[model samples]
Target: MSFSFLPTTNSTTTTTTSTVRMLPTRRSESHSPASRCKSAGHSSSSLSNGFIHSIPTSAASSTQRVNHRQGSLDQLIFKLLTGKPKCLAKVLGGSGVLNTSKNSVAIQTTPIVERDVVSSLQNCSEVRYGANSKPRITNITFSTVTSATGLPTVPAEPNKARSSSYWKTEASHSQSSNNNDTHGTSVDLLRKLSVSRKESGSHVDTVVTTIDGQRYDTKELDSDPDFQEVAEWAFPIFQISRKYPKTVLSRLTYNIFQQAELFRIFKVSPLKFFNFFHSLEKGYWEIPYHNRIHAADVLHGCYYLSVHPVRPQFGVAKSPDSLLPAPQTPAASIMSQMSTLELMALFTAAAMHDYDHPGRTNAFLVQVEDKKAILYNDRSVLENHHAAESWKLLCRTENHFIENLDPAEMKRFRYLVLEYILATDLKQHFEIIMTFNDRIPDMDLQVESDRLLVGKLLIKMADINSPTKPYGLHRQWTDRICEEFYEQGDDERKRGLTITPYMDRGDAQVAKLQDSFIAHVVSPLAQAMNESGLLPILPGLENSELWINMNHNHRKWKEEIESTYEPTTTCNGGSVNGVIEEESASTSDSPDPRRDSPSLDSELSQ
Candidate 1:
């Protein structure tokens, strides 16, 4: 995937056979909108964060409107890709192929090789900033040219038939061959090539020459020792889903790739992100129930389940000879029969189980009596809403990421995506486990082969277990969740609504309640998940265990806060504990918390 940066003074649209030739804008001009596009590329992936899976063509086309408003974002991407600050600025200020005002558009007329030569020369401009105080524009416009319309795509190597391993070995051989001959030059060229490959959708075998007169082949570069880490992280996910349809995975990957591109478009201004935030809030944003990462995880898990010596009571891959239907054969396969679509759905569902979570607990939504609560009649409001919203977002005809899918298969996809995401809600945790117990009537059968019922449970298991990922990652999740909670709490306080105790930071006693809640609820759930072998690779197991071990750690932290400010301890124990205990006592024959002064934290400590 070699990338070339092109520069030209032309900015006119010309017509050609079966396509339009859109000429470049002033490549040497400063204050160009292209400059804006450069900076926008930085956070493209993070911008699309919170979704399960996004289909490429559909997601991109659907978000074209969103992209238009974020024109400056494209400039940033252009800058990043080309490394031309001045040329980037000129492109952004309505001077590039991005003249949306023109009724007509132009396509590339030059051959790909010539374009590469030009693009490379223009790329040299990226390294310099003149004495003039012109702000570099990073944003630029992108116009897609279909191959069928005669536009050239990234060129592929004609006779490169070597396997991936062969290429790696070749790169290694080359690296040691010349200590300084071309190794360092090759490294830099390879980085640009990789980025270009990403942009042009080219194969890894592609080659691009850098300005430093160094030639680098991506295939050879990929064979390096350092590159192995990336391959290791990617291969497991790819191998798991390798059996699935190429289009599904391809589109999924492309969508994620574009999302990273789009993130750069809007991340420059916090104000720009606000529009993005509002768009998301107003419903343009949907975290897909089956997103990319989740799809990868579920597919990976499916592989583990498929090949595991030990099996759960019920789940997918019931048996090798179960005569389960094929996934693509959607109409023929009954819901009971496992198929590729189901597998994809399962994987997709797992990936998008918690797409775009606003991060508050279900209890917070219920206590605040949010509209979501009313919509769901206060029953699993957050869970129900997430599932509903994710589906609604996917239903748009434009966002039909699941292309080439039959109507019947599409319907099934929707159901599976919904069912799986809804099942991920914490409210259904206990019931899901119980269902697992019931579905697997025989212990022997449970361990004999992987059951579809058990696999479903495992899918849900992975979704909830996400927070248990790793200490640093898990803490990051916690922070996001806290941010969401605080946002909700702020809204509640502004509305003069009765806010959930710990949700509202303004409450003097909130810290103590939070500490206690962490002890009893968060820590315990994390521990249970770690012990269950479901999330064997969760982030902070060791650190969390240490935190759990110290009975006085949370208390001491709370006491430190209490020393500065005091408030009436509404419930002698933490509020969450008191509420849970009271609710439990009233609903069952259990003893009341008033009679048992032992705090939930104390109980947990024991």
Candidate 2:
């Protein structure tokens, strides 16, 4: 339906644009430019995405007040092109005919109007720098409306609010539909429970497991140390959710809680943590690991330290009689001095420290050409960002998790949590080891606070302690990291991005990188922590042939990498000291009964 556009006659209405009447179509029920412009309450100077837009009649004058906003305009244009492509082509075709039409003044005015409208539309489509990009509000403008209408050119303003709401509703509807298909009957229940849990207490509406039989609960399980740990890391969970409204923080938090529940039986911290995949956009990570689960595992490890009996066989002093003395006190007194509050602080730190990690190594961030790398000057990009974003999320009004605290107390709590979490960054590895090493009952390392020292040690221990996990669980974790790395690598490839060391996962580097990781990152850390007596709870460590499997895996990777790389360098007393004895007994004429004992390295290696 085409119509002629007549200029307004009233002098007072001269400043205000007259409303153009749009005809209804039988093709489909869609909003016309006039409708959208009117419903959206668009200003007269603003543009519409299509001939039909929702704007209030009152805002018809507002469209004439054109003050250009860069990205806003472009977004309006982009929406018009995508939403009404046919209309856009028609408008451009009409413009060509108008160039020779008898009413040339109208045509001349049309170009000026189109130019300003297009330029304003261009402003709306601008790309954000990083991390701070909010969901864009789309505007529908007049040139787009005219193109669709086949009417004489009429100026119209884009409806910002209504269009934004429409798109949001559409997105919400689509997401709900998708959830219904994937989740079946449980979708509605899950949704209800999810909403309710956020508003209410720890009471869960449902307890369900994944297709793989991994159980998840809305509440923490008591017997599950990992679940307890999840609760610990669930520090400022409410705050994080409130801060990042668009993100699924609650669901991710639940996932962490569930994973901790399933894997806590191992009593090893490493098995409780997982890696998060990163998206194409910077400063965002796909969930599953983030800080919540990582912190949860650390919390679990802390809990284990609190309750699990130290193996007396390892020379660990259970009572004050054998351990040591800080000052004017017996060894037992010193042990008792360590308070639960301090220990809880440490667990909280571990759990909350790496929340919302970007999944990129600090080195990668710095060495790469990304702006974030530049902003942080190449230091701990993920760690720094995580700390900042986590804190930001915590400060929101609705997410006040640590209730009943005064401002001073809150500040102290935040400081402690921040310090503990930030200290988990890999860059602090050397400092943590050196401090722990200096105090290992040999150097002048003062242990003023037993709980604080132990908490710090446990958190650090958990950070670098994945490979020592049970082979099945450890391998699962390893696979997740590889998945994360691959996702990042894929993004880099998409942007014609350069490959960073350790992040790239192409065929050429995959085996090489994995083998190198076993040698440098995994094995050494495992052996050192084991030697340092930080992880005495992992039963059957001597019998468990994880290191042997790691070594074997290393060999396989070397063979796969098309190179004759040597096995990873091992530290003194770290390697399997029993390797020679086991080999000798196996080859003996009369085999020792223990000849079949599993070598620690053999399990993980295989």
Clash count per candidate: 85, 82
**lDDT, each prediction:** 0.36, 0.37
Query: In angstroms, how far off is 451's CA in candidate 2?
Result: 4.6
Q: After superposition, how far is residue 218 of candidate 2 from its true place, in Å?
A: 6.8
* Local lDDT at 145 for model 2: 34
Expressed as tens digits, the lDDT of each residue in 1-606 for candidate 1 is 011222222224321111111122221111123221121111111212211111121113333422323344333333343431233222221011211211211111111222343355357433322232223211111113433223233222222111112112111111233233423443344334434423221222245342222343434443533323221212333333343322223233222322222212211121222222122223312222223334444333333332222212123334577676623311211112233344446655554554455445566556767688789987766557766765655454333345334343455456666666666655555555555545443432212122344455556534433232333333333444455556666777887877755556565454454455444443443333333322222142332222332233444435655675555533333345433211111111211223212353364435
lDDT of 2 by residue, 358-403 (tens): 6655544554656776766666566666667755655543333343
Looking at model 1, report the run of 10 residues with the lowest lDDT sum.
Answer: 50-59
Top candidate by TM-score: 2
- What would you estimate as the lDDT of candidate 2? 0.37
